[model samples]
Target: MDTNIIIVFAIIIVAIFFFIWGKIRSDIVALSVVVMLITTGILTPAEGLSGFSNSVVIMMIALFIVGGGIFQTGLAKMISTRILKLAGNSELRLFILVMLVTGSIGGLISNTGTVAVMLPIVMSMASEAKTSARRYLMPMAFASSLGLLTLISTPPNLIINDALMSGGFESLSFFSFLPIGLITLSLGIMILWPLSKLLVSGKDREKASSSKGKSLNQLVSEYQLADNLYRVSIGENSPFIGKSLQELNITSKYNVSILEIRRVQSRKRFHKPVDMKLAGPASTFQENDLLYVFGNINDIMTFVEDNNLTLVDTQETEMGRNALSVSKAGGMEFSKIGIAEVVLMSSSKLINKRVKESNFRQLYNVNILGLRRKNDYIIQDVKDVKLHSGDLLLVQGKWKDIEKLTEETSDWVVAGQPMENAMKVPRNHKAPVAALIMVLMVVAMVLNIFPTVVCALMAAILMILLGCFRNVEAAYKSINWESTFLFAGMFSLGVAMEKTGASSYMADGIVSGLKEFGPTAVLAGIYIATSILTFFISNTATAVLFAPIAFQAAISIEANPYPFLFSVAIAASMCFASPFSTPPNALVMSSGRYRFIDYIKVGLPLQVIIGIVMIFILPVLFPF
Candidate 1:
């Protein structure tokens, strides 16, 4: 081996060790590797910094903003609410619906964003449906990984696409991988759905009791005499349309409590729980009025028929309909809303800032909905609460703003919340215009109408200007620069390997060892090797390391590179059986309250199932 190649390999080994050690942040480690590679003459200064300007890196940043935009707009929550309404009928069907919705959206949005938005809603739905959230969360994570079908679906696909373009091929088309993606996604779902119960344990019994032993449904279900919530959307010809709750004899004749009255518009205005008393005297029912009433299930059924009210089987109130209509009218997913915990990081400048003084809502579009400090708690009126260091702010906002806070404001870490916020849909007239701009930007990129980075960034900026995002500060905060740095550093490493002919040399050695078994065997070898590497290294790093090698292996065997690339691509994320495998798995491992063995027990079969699906499906779709 050449001396330079030896040095380059040593740097890579050191970098890998640093990443696995998990003491320093991964971005800092990656940046140090890039600097070291440049200093050692392993790569040129331009080569070391080239990844910062790479379309793949830039696109990842913009895509994150797009995901953030969706959250800011309240679209994700709308989907969850709709799912919950339909889910009242069956848990199995609800699980399938959640997976399909998450998978489809994950393909178009950030999987992390999808998971973050859906996690609480699904947990809530699980509570309402009397089932364990464990049955659904893993599927959400897995389905998010199913974003492999489209060029714009995930960062990994974009990285691979960018690499292929760099290697002298046109970019992969938007739906190029759908045939295989859909198959793998479907098969993975089929195997996991039936086995998830047997493989993964339910919620921790002691912990569940501590939090609240009663499921939402159980809390409501026992009200055999009263206390069930009936959410009905008033229809045009409905007899209840002109009457107040008192006139309708809802509370007088039946054991019932009206929880809220919501007006659906270009935005949704929710009548507070305290406002329920006004429902009987002050309110006149209007078309599409979403009335949430609590009563005995039997009384609610009778009330609905007697008053001729149509129970809104949909989870959404008329308010959500307006949000969805705006989104669809503009051609996109509805804007999303959520509750998030933003922990004050040691380095955050806002460590001691009060919510009012911080202007979080006006500046970033985030509302400090509540505060948590150890056992201390404060409700939505946080504007009056004094801020303190180490406090975790329970915030509500468009998904993008929360994302920006977690990424850019070194002051906050995102912790999941299993609670709902008061539904207040703010009107953003720019919804349609913002959607059009984003869709156009995407279409332009697919057609090669503009540089991907410029197109996406421009659309993102326009979103900020139009109030699709609250502001540019939030947009800037949404970029995960750590992953961006990792991409740049790893790209430099790949370039060094390619320039040194190290990749070709390594490919030759691998091919010689596996040549006896042909290209199929060689592809399988690459997949398994990448899978092992991913267990130790991060998925993006593993992909960066093996993608070039996979291409070279294909050349050596005189076979199409697509199958080999596809194999490594799938294997890169199929790192189950270990906690250190992927961040998503790590997230659930901790939050799901599972031991290390829990991952091995549940994940091992899923891993085997993934391998089978990929190996069987890849050859048929891409053909060696």
Candidate 2:
């Protein structure tokens, strides 16, 4: 091997060690590799920086925005609701439904987003079924992983596609991996659906059930807020129809505080009717606006009659009853409204201060809906009560504001599941437009009307132009910068490996080791290697590291590289065996009260099954 290749190999070894060590972040480790390659004279500055301008990076950013548009429009949540309706009370039926819906949707949107959207639904379903979330959450996490079978499903797919394109092969089409994806998804559902009962232990179920002992409704009853939450709609002739919250001063006039507003937008084709908006001082009350108000039952009833408003009996409508859940308040528009349980830290500045005196609402734009101190519940007049260390406050506000509150860790420690600000709102009015853009993008790619990168860019821009996303800032925020940087750095590292001949050196060893058993064994070896690497590092990083080696191995054997490349892609996504392997798995770990062994028990078998399926499928499909 050349001196440069030896140096590059040493750098990579150090990088891999750091990745597994979990001290520095993967992105930083990747960036350090790029900087070391540049400093070592292995790659020119232009070559090292080329990844920032790579088409794959641009496609990733565009896809993030497009996925955000789909999420922002509440399309995923709508699908979940419809599927849940069909699932009923059977745990088995619910598990299958969750896997099917989340997997299918994960193909189109970010799998992480799909998991975030489906989590609460699964939790609620598990609760309603009188079962533990553990019975359902592991399957849900695996389904999100299965979603990567689609070409547009996850970042690893894009990375592998870009690798193939860079190697001078025709880029894989959007549906190229459909056959394997479908088979894998079906297999996952089959294994996880029935095995959930055994894989998820009874002890775990008992622990989860005991922890979440009180349902949301039960808590509401405990707080005596059942009658305080009233759903009323503004009548066509109501005087408040054209007025803003500040203008009407409903809090003063009717002695009721407006908590949320659900308004139906003008009817559009293929769009759902209602759009939920958080109520604020500047928000206008329109005709037919559904107001969720908090006040004495008698006062609210008298105000409804006096103001020509219709009181909506929540008991009569499922939507009404759903609105009663504090966690479900921010289901519409991702960040519009959210509820969080925050615990005051021991050294919190607000520990002894009254909520009103601290100007909590003014400072954070969040309402102290309720508070819990030890065994005591303080629901009414929370603003006047003094906060204590270890006091848990149930706060409601814009998700962004709540996020800000949580970040002030010196003052508060957020309890329970970490608030995911990516909740979808009912922006179904924009769904048709968003769907049209995505369809066109897919068509353009499938037919080679444009490069995949260009098609993705056009779709992303259309999402903004069509109002699927509210603004450029929204689009910008939607992009996961960590992922973008990580991929960019990894791309450079891949280039360094190739330029320094490190990839060829590694490929020769892998090819020579398995050549006696022929190409099928070689392919299986590559897949297993990639899968093991993914268990420690990110699937994206694993794909990047292995893609070049796979291509080099095929070159050494004088056979087609497609099968080897496909194996790397498939294997990278088989990161189901570890809780830390994927974001979705980690997200569900605490809520499901799952231990690391739980993932190993469930994911290891699924990983082996997928490997067996891939070994048989790849050679036939790619003709290696």
Candidate 3:
């Protein structure tokens, strides 16, 4: 191989390794590849950096900001709530509705954008429906994958469509892949329908619990005991001490339901609620009954004040009332006191540390309410158990406390939302306008009213002018610049491969091996191969790598390249075999609290189903 070819392959090898190993951040890996390509003379400085200016890169960056704006304004949240309410018939029906909504919206917008917009919405609705957020998140992510069946659905499809035209083939039109894509999408959704029930089957009985750090009094309007209702404060020295509600006759005599209660004092010592005797009804009504009664507001107030039974002050409550509904909103609105699920990594300081010995609450103010070890859920007095690697903790605390915990215990990997502040997405009203502009631009481009790249550029410029990006920093930060660099680096690598006959060399080998197996087999091979590549590379890069060869193969067989090319596009875009396959997959990795094995277990089967549908349906629509 020539020096340039050697350099290109070296970059490819490093990129693939980075994707698989993933110890380093992906953007850094991409930038390193760009630097290497430039340093080795494989690409000139301008050529290596040309991806920054690539229309696709610019459009993607702009769309990310627009998507962020949508999230900030809660537009996506509003839409998801409406859709979910409409999906109230059945799980299967709900599954189909969610899939259609996600795929349809994703097709018009970017997949990552679609996911970002819908993530909080999906989690919230899942929580409301009393389902595991993990069960629904993967399906939502898969919907984004399936949306890539259309030319405008995702960046990769648009890039590939343009590349086809540049390569002397007719550009794919709107809904070009609908027949194959919809069938594949429907099959994948159906496969996922049974998954929610399967994974959460055994854990169904444990309802979501309330956190103790905040008070519930702040959540709802309060009323006091009514007039003519007897009122008494049970002091530590009171006669009714250690009496349960049944023993006290609270309901029969006073008609008091004991609506809510909170401990009057807290202990520095780690306390565990054991048997009903230790913490239950026998525990007795403590000082400050904090009783709420169903009666006239005026009457209740008069009775409580008259009897000297004071209402609990906001500061005296365990948790603010506003935070009480975290589970109620289905996971959407919750206390700012952050809650995260962390796993004990092999390197964590928490490994082998007993919860009591660790003093997590005092040190970081983070409460470890529960844990999941293997398949068992531990909600007991967990102070005794030594933490182990891979142990999952249900930690609730302030954002700063969570940050400290993550930093101090490297072995404990925080699953969702970094300790760092959320990125500042532009919140101006113009963002929706910018999004509308982008939609109009895409429509105009598809209609051949203007070049796709040019239309996208104009929309981006208009967005900047409209102050959709607050400043140059906002605009610069909005785009995933690393993706651009990766494209540039890979474009050069692809060029080098073509220049050195590496591409043709590989294509000839594949063709010769599959020729006897027929074009259908050859086509299937290309689809599967590209899909595998996508599990380790950018979808666009995967398309760029295999699209040319697919086109060439179609020519060799004297067939139109549309069906073959469509297969490559859809398959490459559905890189669901690993968490590293796509950004949405990465997002769900932490959000869904999923393990590597979980992705393989769920995604591998779904990918196979989509591949089968594509192979069987593509030829019918486009005709080989």
- Return the top candidate by lDDT: 2
lDDT string for model 1 (394-503, tens) is: 55455555567656556666653222221223223444554566567656655657665677677767767767655566667656566556655566766676677665
Candidate 3 or 2, higher lDDT = 2
lDDT scores of the candidates, listed in order: 0.61, 0.71, 0.59
What is the per-residue lDDT of model 3 for residues 362-392, given as tens digits with 9 covering 90 to 100?
A: 5666656557798776644455678988987
Question: Where in model 1 is the C-alpha error above 4 Å?
Answer: 88-95, 105-178, 190-438, 441-451, 529-609, 616-624
The superposed Cα distance between candidate 2 and the true structure at residue 493, in angstroms, equals: 2.5
Off by over 4 Å in 3: 1-18, 35-54, 89-94, 108-120, 123-138, 148-151, 154-173, 194-505, 533-548, 559-562, 578-602, 620-624
Off by over 4 Å in 2: 83-226, 231-265, 269-294, 301-312, 315-433, 469-474, 508-624
TM-score ranking, high to low: 2, 3, 1
Superposing every Cα of model 3 onto the true structure, what RMSD results?
14.2
Q: Give residue 297's error in model 2 in angstroms.
A: 2.8
How do these models rank on lDDT, best leading? 2, 1, 3
Error of 3 at 524 (Å): 2.3
RMSD of each: 12.6, 8.4, 14.2
TM-score, cand. 1 vs. native: 0.51
